[model samples]
Structures are given as C-alpha cells and as structure tokens.
Target chain A: MNLPKSVSIIEVGPRDGLQNEANFITTEIKKEFIQHLVCAEIKEMEVTSFVSPKWIPQMQDAAELIQSCYSSIRSIVLVPNKKGAERLLATNCKSAAVFVGVSNRFNQKNINKSTRESIVEIRPIIADLKSKGFFVRACISTAFYCHYEGAIATADTLALCQEFADAGVDELSVADTIGMATPAESFSLFSTLKQQLPNIMIAAHFHDTRKMALANIYAALQAGIDRFDTSAGGLGGCPFVPGATGNVATEDVVYMLERMNIKTGVKLDKLVKAIDIIAPHLSRKIDSGYYQLTKKRDISV
Target chain B: MNLPKSVSIIEVGPRDGLQNEANFITTEIKKEFIQHLVCAEIKEMEVTSFVSPKWIPQMQDAAELIQSCYSSIRSIVLVPNKKGAERLLATNCKSAAVFVGVSNRFNQKNINKSTRESIVEIRPIIADLKSKGFFVRACISTAFYCHYEGAIATADTLALCQEFADAGVDELSVADTIGMATPAESFSLFSTLKQQLPNIMIAAHFHDTRKMALANIYAALQAGIDRFDTSAGGLGGCPFVPGATGNVATEDVVYMLERMNIKTGVKLDKLVKAIDIIAPHLSRKIDSGYYQLTKKRDISV
Candidate 1:
C-alpha cells in the first residue's frame, strides 16, 4: 500500500501510439494532438520516431512534427541507430529516445540487428547525446517477455539496462513489448532495476494487450517507479508484435493515479478531450476504459 | 509482494451477468453455460436470482436452471428478502446470497428499501437460513463508492458487514457496485475488513466500469484476500447503476493469477469456451481483455 505522493506521466501516444497505425495522419493534426496534450499539462512526451519512411511510413514527418512542437515541452523523439541519432541532432528537440530489444530475435525482426550490435552502436550515441547536454532515454523493449522469445530472463533485462545506465542515459523506459507480463514479474524486475540503478530514472512502459497494464503499473509504483509512458485513447501497438494493443491510456492512468491520491499534475477533463483529437483518425475504436465511459455516460471525472 | 499462494474464484456470470440483459437467453443455454464453467473447474457459482419474474424475467427459470446443474458444484441463488428466501427453500438449492447497499439512496432505488430497513429485515433471514442449514453469503454492495451517494464512508460499509457477520453469514462478498473505487480505496477498505473481521471469509467483487478492476484486485491481493467474485466473459453490470460495466472477466483473472503462480484451479482455455456459450446472446459485445486477445491472435494460453 506504500506509494509515491506524486507521479510523472510521459505521453507516448503521438509516437509509440501512431507508429503502428496504417493510416496516415497529417502533420497538422499531429501538432494539434500535441497541443492538446500540452494544455493538459503533459511536461514530456515521445512525439515521433526518426526512422525510415519505407519501414514505418507512419512516422515519415518526424522531423516536421518535432520542429513544430512547443519548445517548452520536453519532446522526445525515437532514434533507432546512429543515423537516427544524426537525424535527431539536426532537429530542435533536445531530448532523444533510443531503443533495443532484450531478445535477439525480436531485435532482428524490429531493426535487423543483434542485441549486442545495437547496444555497441547505441552506447557511443548515448555518450554523444549526453556530451551535448541532451536528455537520452533508453527504451528497453521486451524487458519482461517477447513475442518471438518467451519469458525474458530478469538477469538479461537487468544486464541490458545496466549497459545503458553505464552509457550515461538520463532514464530507462523498460517495456512489456507484447503486454504479457504479470504483476509479480513486473514487481520482480522493476524492484531489481530500482535497487541496482538507484541513481537513474526508470519508467515503466506497458502495452494493454493482455489487459494487465494498470496492475503492472501499480506493481511498478510499489517498486517506487513514478514515471509512466501512456498513450491517449489507448492508441498504438507494435506492428512487429502481433495482437499487441495500445499503450495504457493516458486518461485511464490519470484517473487511477488521481483516485489513489497520487498527483500526476494532469487535468482529467482536458486529458479526455485530447483523445477526441486523434480517436477519429485511427482505424480502431478507442478502447480506453475511462474514455469510453465518458462517451457513454454524462458523468464528470 | 506478500500474497496468498492460491485464490478461489466464484463465478457470477450466470446470474449477476445475465440479470441486467434485456434479451432473454433460453434455459438450455444457461444450463450449458454452467456446464462449461463446471468443466473449467469452477467449484461454485451464483447460478440465478429468485426475484419476481416481472422485475428480472431473465431469472424466471432460476429454479429450473439450478435443478439441472451438476450437483457436485456449489450453486448459489440470490434471495433479496423473505419472499425470495421462501422461494429458494422450495427448491433443493442449499446456498443463498443476500445483498444490501451501503448507500441508503442506492438501496431505495435498487430494492425500494432504506439501508436500515434492508439490514433489519435481512438479519433474521440470515439466522433463519443458518438454522435451516443453508449456507449463506451476504453481498455488500457499494462497499467503496455509490452512484447516488458519491463516495461511501468506509465506516458505514464496515458497520453493515458487522451486522451480517454477527448474524452468522457463511461469507461476506464486498462489492464495488459502480466500479469507481480506486486501488487505494480498495486496499484501505478491504484491509480494514480483513483486520477487523479476521475470522470471516471475505470475497472482493469489482465492476470494470473504469478499468481499474484488475488493479483493485491486485491491491486486494496485497491486503491478503484470496477469493474473488468474477463473471465469465466479463459479464454483468448493475441495471440500476447508470454507467456501470461488467465484472472482471474470469478468464482475465485466471490468466493473471496463473501467471503470478497463484493457483485458481481453473483452466483458462476451457473457461474461455464458457464465454462462447452466452456471448452471442448478450446485447453488448464481450469487453474482457483476455477474451479479445484470444480471438484476435492464434496465441495459445
């Protein structure tokens, strides 16, 4: 029952949420979505990814999206490799996010590189970003389980995160890539990470594919994690991870945290409104519990 | 992280799930649904209610359905008052469930009785049923929050449960009728109930109106609770609560518990099959997370 007094939510709907979307959303709408999130008091977010348009055509306008976003917000863009990092250096964004899967097979499928190779390539990039006073967050995908490889060994995930921590990253966002982690697994891994890497900020990113996202978040909170990566309207899934659903919805996370007396400094009503901006653009229905409840009933948060 | 090694699940989909449905399912389908749950190793279930046929036509065949169920399973029938209790006695059913809401306004709207009136009337009914060797479960509705009265006082809920415990009910089923209870509220209320009434068997019932059911369930588990009231396919919502959704799905709960290494003695794949029996008959789509994942992907549990 011991929980933090306040938690920080890092919005990921614009990037992680929309990357898997097949339909193209215009840069204007994406900017408008980020503006709505800014009004809702989201201080940090993963706005877009600097990747090849041929691979993920959805993020073709990453540079444009990052340049147009409000400079007051700590907009973080995903950089997959040295090329992506170089692409990010040209943009106005001061924050950059890099990722590597814990599973080699998943890494091979996602970026066509082995885990060791991605780590070796990304280490110097992290140091370079830090040397330039850039905030670098390492997103450790499949930290708990992988779609290609079954349950990930906790030691493997911990070792991978240790490498990133040693590389001078500001934070580590460990993810349940396929959303198959149980609360026990979440608590076990995050508690170890928090113990070993006490100086580094660790955020828990979860996909709601199995509907255990909130429970996993709660476990993470018990392990003293305060930062979360959430999607608006529960949008986004990994195109590489089959049957994966959206990240835990921002509105849903805010609702739970506020109800628990944990401060996220986000307005629930305004947060719910942000979902309306992007819900229609997506091919799937908004599956967020709080959003759907607000639509069906006249209840105020 | 201290949790029970195993948990028991009481299936409420047949009665609590279907009572609110406007469409009537045939008695044969209801029997087959119960049979499927039995095959999934559900040892106990709330099969049906003995309310007036005019009010809930869905349960008009309560007696008929219970009579046809497997005798080895513990079948519980809902009895609202003395009349419902008398009707339950007419059948061969040995278990009866009675309910009272914590909010007086919610009680009046749901059953046309004040909270005090309902408690006063049901006390002797519990005694009478106990004297007759009938196992009784007293369902405490709005244990955390009420739709009409807003957030309910934990003291009010505890006092009402105290009355039932004094009257010798076999177990107490504490419910979050509106699904508005947070994990903190759930942990605070249930932990007190567990500490105060240490000798009694207590079960947690949650509605997924806000999608915090699983998190609330996890909080309850941390508070030392091991029995839960779940619905197959996430079926059932209070017809009286305006925006209330279904209970936490049995399959999802089993998936979490089994993954956490907590035994529920329920086979998830077989439990999902039970949903197929009644899902087509319901007016709304099944909203369970695990159920949706199973249908979308070929991944085996």
Candidate 2:
C-alpha cells in the first residue's frame, strides 16, 4: 500500500505493556525499554502512571521508572485524580493524562465511581494539571462499549467528552476499552466529538481484543482525528478487562498506514530493530503477525 | 474483545500460505497441513489450486494433496481460468474460485494477462462451472492498492466488480492486496459494492502487511458485509508485493468477533485444539499475536 509521507507513533509499552506483566520487571529494565524506544527514534512515550499499588501492582514503580529515564521525547503519565495529579507535580514529565469512563458500568469497574462522579472528580485534576503548564489530556474509556453494560450510548459519551473539554484538557483521547467498536461507531463518534468540541485535539486509544484496533484508527483518521496510542509488538491489552487482548501493534499500525499513503512518521526498519532488542526480555514470544511475517529470516531463526 | 456468537474459520494456509514459501513441502506434508487445519476446527477450506505445476511447483500435486485428505469439511480449489477449472472438473471438491484484479499491472504480473483479459478468460470458465452445477466464486484482487500502481480509483474497482456480478458469480471478494486500505475506504467500498450488487454476497480478503487487515474487516462489517477470508495461524501474505506480510489470522479474527457477540459460527476452543496437529510441521512460527500471547503454557514452552 502507498502510505502517507509520515505518521506519529505514541509509544505506550512502558505504561500499557509493562503494567500487566506477571514479573515485576525492575525499574531499571523499565528504563531499558524506554531507552530502546528512544533508540528506535520514537519521539513520544507513555512512560508510567501515578497510582496506588493497591489498585495495580504493575504500575507501582511508575514514579521510579520515570525518574530514571532521561530523554528529550515527550513522556505521558496516567493520573487518576487530584491526588494522583499532585503526586506527579514533582516529576519533570511534561504531560499528565487523566481518565474517566463514558459507560457507567465501566466507570464503576475501572475507578469505583459512577460516570458522572468520575467526571466531576477528574475535572479538577485536569484543571490542576493545566494550571501547572503541563499538557493535560482526558482519556475517555468505554466510549465505545462496556462489557458489563453492553453498548455505550452516544449521548452519555458526548457529555463526558464535553466535561473533559470544559475542564480545560489540552487533548482528548477516545478509547474502545473492550475493543467492541466497529468503524462506523468510531467514525461517527470521532466525527461528532470533533463537531461538538471543535477546540479539542483528539487522539485514539483502541484495544485489539476484537482485532479492530487498527481499523478504529483508520476510522478516526477519516473523521480527521490524529494522534494514536499503540503498544510495541502489539504488546499491551489490559488484564483488568477480561477478553481484551492487546493494543494495535505499533509496527503493524505504521505498516498499514504507510502502505495506504498515510504518514505515520514511524521508521519501519528501526521499529522492527527495536522489537529485536525486546525479544529476549520477556519469557514468552511476542505475537505481532506483522513482525513474525516481515522479520528477516536471520533474526527469526 | 467481545465477539459474536461464533465466526467461521476458512483455512487458507495450505493454498495461500504455502504458495509463497520457498521451501518445497512435498505432497505428504501438504496432506498433513490439511489434516491439521481440520483438527483446528476450520469448517471451510481452500485447499489447493488447479494451476499448472510448471508455474507453481509448490502446488504441483493437486490430486495427491486432495486425495490424501482425511477430513469431512468442504474444500475448494482456486482456478485462474477455464483451463485450471477444467483440471478440477473430475474431483469431488465441489467448488473453485477465480480471481480478477482491479489493477491491470497486478493482473499482468500475477497471471500474465490484463485485468479485462483475465475477466474474459474467467467468465467462460465460470459458465462451465455453472453448467457442471459446481459452486463458484470470483475474487477481485487489488481492490485497494497495487505495488505497481497506488490508490486505485473506486470507479475502476466498481467496474470490475460489476463485470463479475453481471457474469452471475455467487459471491464477490474484495482484497487489499498490499495492506494499502483504511477502514473508511473499506466501508465506502463495501457500501458501494453491496448497494450496486444486492443479490451477490460480499467477502473481505485482507493482508496484514501494513497492519490494517483487522481494521479493514471492521469497516466491512460496519458496512454490513460478512463472509471474510482468513488463514490458519495467520499464514501467507503476497511476497511479490513489498511490505505485505500475512493474512489476518483466523484464530485472532474468531476471538475478536466471537467475543463481540456477533454470529460467526466458529468455536475457539475447537480451533485451538485443531492447531495441535500441525504446529510442529509449520516451517515458521505462527504469525498471530493473540495465539502467541494467550498460548497455553505447555505448547509455548
């Protein structure tokens, strides 16, 4: 396929992939992962999160991981509320991502709060993040569907996006947490989200559990939204969300977009090389059809 | 990902996957691969091609490969034209598929015939198949892009598709040969194809070279198209087409669609069980991220 001249790769393996690994993966190794990402010519990375270990053990060392990493690339962190935002205040990371679920059931399951309650709670945190002159993004989860509650309504999702925008978030991330979306849903939602909130720059977060992550990205692109969150090797799919498999593999996404003449700004050979550096670290083989297929035989053997 | 109630697994490994492999897998091994696909619970299979042995040594043994098979599943062979279709007339295979390329350059490169010439050649062949009461399908290739020519116009694709529909082919299959399509393009194409040809069923054949296969499938589904073509273990991509990697994995597609609560009529546990029979003989590791990530520990080790 003829791809666009360039596209962006927002690396999320450090925060999304590592967050669910069974092994602790010391903060240093986490640093190595980030280091290799940079060596691969990556310009943006979601390094870690500021959250209590009680909720997720994988992210317990987020603060430490970020502290150890030294790079010019933009580093984004996940912050749940004002307390989490306050904790990131001391870190030098340039961006903070605040999340709220659009589906009521997902909000309750993800953060132990109602959709409205989570929106109200995350708003001030967003304001606080903006006040600090940091790039603040509101990640709207289950904006597509919720496993517990089934399909999410457009009205409910729109209200949450408006709240995030009104809260002064610099950017908005619409996510299909369960990978339950089709291109039609993504296109309509992204298009409507843009029409209503004309000022917000939108990024897309899709789960590949249903194998539609890349397609969702394509739909979002058609709706004129750019910026995407993808895991290296298609590495990250949330463990907390049952049936969810992985995010769109970074290399695969870059490959598809590039061939279609859409610019993803990702270096193909360099990204594949980065996957090589990561191959030995994990106990299991990484599953990216794109990598397994295109990888030169010498490396595969 | 939430899947539909079930999804159908169309095993294309033996025909599609092995076609590009440089290694000479003998007739005996080809039989074993077919058996393994059945073990994987694949309900429908495209097992072999009736093309000349001189051109494709990999598929030289159409008779032995088909005769040695031990399963009860329906099998179809791919025929480029009346000559290939004539070779398969004596077999009990019941069905065969002919291809039409949207790009003349690809058609000439692939079958040594121009796009219109290929269609003309296949029409009479399709008529003969009809007379014999054999089920036949016409696959339109390069519906999205071509290595030699980029971003094919929709009108050209539609004209080719209309030609096949007018010929009374039972189904229409659109392929993104080089992984060059996005969901918007897929949706738009599928919508237009379906609207123009209401009686004929539409199937999607995608390559994952640029990581947009699943996304394209999602778009087709949104456009209300079903009956997709996928490979066992995500085998086979068009090698001649640079940057193309593999077809969307059958297991991954099943997992995603089944979890979505759509009706695909495939069983996942049965599918995984089916793979055990041929996993060892596979020349390369399976190119599927979900299978690699969620592999049963015993097999992975």
Best candidate (score: TM-score): 1
C-alpha DockQ for predicted model 1: 0.71
On lDDT, the candidate that comes out on top is 1
What is the Cα-based lDDT of residue A201 in candidate 2? 80
lDDT of 1 by residue, A3-75 (tens): 9999999999999989988989999999888999999999999999999999999999988887765788899
Q: Name the lDDT value of residue A268 in candidate 1.
A: 79
- Where does the lowest 10-residue lDDT sum fall in candidate 2 chain A? A292-301
Task: Tell me the lDDT of candidate 2.
Answer: 0.75
lDDT of 2 by residue, B1-301 (tens): 2222334556677788778776777777677667766766676788998877777777888877777434477687899877788778877677778897899998888889998889778888888887888777788889978878877999999998889888878877788887767766887898888899999877888877656777777767767776888886777877556556678888777765665557666655656555544556666777565666456342210
Worst lDDT run of 10 residues, candidate 1 chain B, spans B292-301
Comparing to the true complex, what docking class would candidate 1 get? medium
Cα lDDT tens digits, model 2, A76-195, are 899987778877888877798888887777778777889788777877777777777989878888887876777788998888788778888888878888776876577789889889
RMSD (Cα, Å) for all candidates, in order, is 1.1, 6.3
Query: What local distance difference test score does each model get?
Result: 0.90, 0.75
Worst lDDT window (10 residues) for model 1 chain A?
A292-301
Q: List chain B TM-scores, each candidate.
A: 0.98, 0.91
